[model samples]
Target chain A: MSIIKAVHLRKRFIVKKKEPGLKGALKGIFAPKKIIINALDDVSFSMKKGEIIGLIGPNGAGKSTTIKILTGILQPLSGEVEVMGLNPQKKRAEVVSRIGVVFGQRSQLYWDIRLGESFELFRRIYRIPDEEYNANLELMDSLLGIRRLIDIPVRQLSLGQRMRGEIVSAVLHSPDILFLDEPTIGLDIQAKRNIRKFIREINQKKKTTIILTTHDLGDVQELCPRLVVINKGKIIEDGALDAIVHRLAPERILQIDTDKVKKDFTYPHCKMIKCEENKMWISFNRENVSASKLIAALSAEVRINDLQVKEPDIEDAIEQIYGEG
Target chain B: MRCAVQSWFEYPLEMLCWIIFIPLYSFGGLLLLKVISTQFSEIGGWTFHGLAFFYGLGIVTHGLHVIFFFAVWHTNYMVLNGEFDRILLYPMNPFFMFIIQSFNIAGYIDITPGIIIFTYACLKLNLDWNAVAILKLIAVLIGGTLIRTGIFMIAGAIGFFRDTRNAVTNFMVDFLAYNTTAFPLNIYPYGIQVILTFLIPVGFINTYPAQDFMGMDNTFSIPINLSLCTLLVGIAFFLLAYGFFRFGLKHYKSTGS
Candidate 1:
């Protein structure tokens, strides 16, 4: 069963024009002008159950807008969005209870209260039974390792500790679907790794459907195998991560550093992409040109000191997808 | 509920301030009441002590509203700054959260002054300290706090739709209007009585009790006083507020913090 189904979910925001100074203010009273900005234009996508999908986009690419609509915080101008077989806008309370969302920097816990109090409050809110409550508590404490921090006031916890506690609070009742926006943002390397591991573990073990929106490519590449790239309020690519990488930049890049410049041997099989500073890089399809043959031909002419293979970065490929479209 | 109240104990400075402020305010209130008592023999048909008694009750009630619903009024600041987005993401009603956030001991400052006036009125009035009067006073309390708190809640709910909640100024205007008019409903022109009893509802907050203790007659005594304007208008205002809140939420564009 598809957990999320959104089709042509158009959200248009009115950009009101503000006049300047006294004269403009006086004129504004009489003739106010508004410009319409299509935040999301004819956007469509569907995610199957237990699928961990990456929602990647630049600023103002309708990432938060889409999430808000799906969460029933805002209504779309037109089109349909269904989460778990319920219209989010019409059935907000029911839909919200089933999905958990964590805005990376936002802390949902009380500022002066301990983590234990917040969890208890959530327990009352979700109306979880004592047995299920203990089970989920044990699971969250192990997955996020927030057991020791439970008694500490939220304001006293370190950023990483606070974020872990926040994540636990979001999923305390074990929501079926989770939306994480920039979850690893502002975290140190070790904290980021822990978060990534926990996210992957839950998706694999609990079968929690995860839709992550992030500008950090490493989070998506490592944690989300399925990628959905959006730009300017429209989706440019939606498929597996490897497919987007291959489609956006087809060939792998090969760099050769030599002691001297190499003679131009336009290998019909391989294409020379760029050459600079006694170094040249070429791209060749593996199926078209054999790596040994190409390397042997290039090395036969110039004394190659270092050779390395590089695939196009997912970040660049997504950016190129935005640029070309 | 228990945990929310316990959190207040953790902040000693905050609770201590409330303990200090409540007495400070009560003492200050007596000084002003004394000035009014000395010059003005009576407001409306009551004696100096009767006016002082109701004034203390009003202050105590106001103090309660300040402490219990302080966070409710502060929601405007929280919502405007986008701090409320986090509260919204929580499973609980954000409005309910604000009410439970703090235990307002801050307004206790007025109790000292209120007690001073009450003690002074008791001594000066020299009335029988009997069961009936005390029971009537208790009844007045039940109605007074409800009406006052109800007004504040209506105003707080109005904040969901407007830029600023300046409706609190109505408190001053209400005190002035009800305190000046001599006698209860009857002495006034029928038109004025109807407006006070039904349309405005401010009269019941204090004047209804003034009639009960003083053995005076009002235009519309017990039944109308407790029924019309106060409770009815209060409930209607509450429903109106609920409507405004849901309407405002649809248009609310919570700013990104």
Candidate 2:
């Protein structure tokens, strides 16, 4: 089922422009220039239940704005958004109650209080029943090993621990949909692995639908099967991760280290992009030339010492989209 | 509210300092009133005890306002920092959540000296303490707090449209609330008195209610029970301010992260 839908979402902000120097400051006090920023323009997408979709984009590409609109923290100038068959803007309280959100740059937990205390406060705010709250807390503790960090003040906890606490706080009420905005923006590898495991566990155990917006391609590669690539306030590409990679970045790099230089060496279905001394870099479409075939051709021309095949990743695919945009 | 109090208590030294300093601050104000009383037997037709009563009443209302509605003062900061976005994301009523999240236990320190001064003034005046009178005092405190909070809320709501950085709220608290409500309104010219009573309504917070308590005749020519008007005006003004705040919410352009 389509659990979330947005149609032609448009949002704009009026920003004040102040010129440089003292005279400009004085003039700004009198009459400042105003500029309009179209934060989101004609952005539309839909998500099905129990699916993990990555919303990836460059900085200031309206990723956060789209998440805010979906969560009803923002109102679009023109659009229709429906979450769980209800208009999010009109039924904000109801919609918010059914959805959980985590903004990695911002925190919902009280900084001066214990992590457990903050969770208790959220429990009261979300009105979660004591039984369900306890159950969820236990599940989170088991999955993330958060029991040790619960007594520490949020300000005192390490970023990774605090982020685990944040995720637990968000899901204490058992929301059906979860929005994670840059959830792994700053974390060590172990911490990031723990969070990803927890997220996968939650989705598998509860079938929670998740919308993840992030710049971390590793996060997208591991967690999201579907991807929505946005740039300059527009949805440029949306499909399965494999499909996007195939369409945008189908070329693989072949690095070959040869014993001797071959000035006139050439091959079909591949181009040598770089050559220096006895080393060469070849670019080839994966569909047109297999790594073995290219290796065979290079060996026939020159004695090969070492060779390596580099596959294109999600980063390359997203860069391809951003470059076109 | 529990979390707010818990966090406040976490700072032992700061909490101790605030506890000690609040009563000392109230005592300093009382000393000023004492000096003024010694200089003039009656200023603006009110004796030293009547003035003490008025001052104590104002302090109590101020304490309550600080305790319950102090978060309104930070609306500008919250809007600028995008912290207001989290408040909106909550399922609860954002205004109620904002107020509750900032429930300050330090305000109880302010109330301690206020109650002592109010009790001292009552004893000096030989005022009859009845159930109705006690209820009236509670009602007056609530009304006065609502008035103070409503005015500040209006000022705070302006943050949604412009980045005032709380200049307007500071002005209102300093000039309208402190300068006027802390003294007998009758000391001002008749025009200023009318403005305080009807236009800005700071007079209704303390001066008008104190007039009713002291059984003094209404200074203004307007035909209205000034005491009864306090609660009504407070409710009406608070509702209007909340409506304005809601209007601002509709136009809230949340700051970028």
Model number with the top TM-score: 2
Against the native complex, each candidate's DockQ, computed on alpha carbons, is: 0.30, 0.72
Number of backbone clashes in candidate 1: 13
Instruction: List the candidates' TM-scores in order.
Output: 0.82, 0.96
TM-score of 2: 0.96
The alpha-carbon deviation from the true structure for residue B243 of candidate 2, after best TM-score superposition, in angstroms, is 1.0
Q: Give stretches of model 1 more than 4 Å off.
A: A12-36, A263-274, A284-297, A322-325, B90-98, B102-204, B207-223, B227-229
lDDT of 1 at B97: 60
Docking class of 1: acceptable
> lDDT of model 1 at residue B220?
57
Encode model 2's per-residue lDDT on A1-325: one tens digit a residue.
6999999999998988999999999998899899999989999999999999999999999999999999988889998999999987889889999999999999999999899999888888899999999999999989998899988999999999889988998899999999999989889999999989988999999999999998889888999999998988999989999999988999999888887867667778788888899898889998878888778877888898988888888788888898888
For model 1 the local lDDT of residue B84 reads: 48
User: For residues B1-257, could you state the per-residue lDDT of candidate 2 as single tens digits?
Assistant: 98999889789999999999989988788888888878987787788888889999988998899888889888877877888778887898889988998998888988888888888999999988799787788778888999988888888888888977877667765578777876789899989988887777898888888888998876775466666678888888889889999888877777775
